[model samples]
Target: MRMYEIVLDGELTSDLPATAGPVGRRQEGGSTVLSVPAAGRDALEEVLGLLESLGIGITAMSEVEAPA
Candidate 1:
């Protein structure tokens, strides 16, 4: 699995859909940061699709080391 940090353009007003995987969510400035774990590209894409469907705009995304 891989960990990813997705930074959204605005604060999330509600909880993320369950399919987003086991996520760590928090706000940093005006952005909502989501720490998601995916098994592969397909899993990551699924989360991205869910975010798009929710009308959330992603400002940035990058792979990250798993939290201890």
Candidate 2:
């Protein structure tokens, strides 16, 4: 599994998935963090497509190693 951190200018959906969807939550100093996870290539592409369709610009992403 891999995790991707995406930053956008606006808000996102709440019913996101834990494996391959966006999760919005409040952070330090009232900032919001939107995170998503991808298990493989197909999952990652699906996430990108979703973001593109929503017109939500993705700022940055980091690949994280998932624990077994």
lDDT of 2: 0.57
| lDDT of each candidate versus the true structure | 0.81, 0.57
Name the 10 consecutive residues with the lowest summed lDDT in model 1.
35-44
Runs of candidate 2 with Cα error greater than 4 angstroms are 16-34, 65-68
Q: Over the stretch 15-53, how does candidate 2's per-residue lDDT look in tens digits? A: 445555444343433333454565556666776676687
Residue 37 in model 1: lDDT = 77
Q: What digit string (tens of lDDT, one per residue) describes model 1 on residues 15-68? A: 776765677789999888987775566657877898898788999999988777
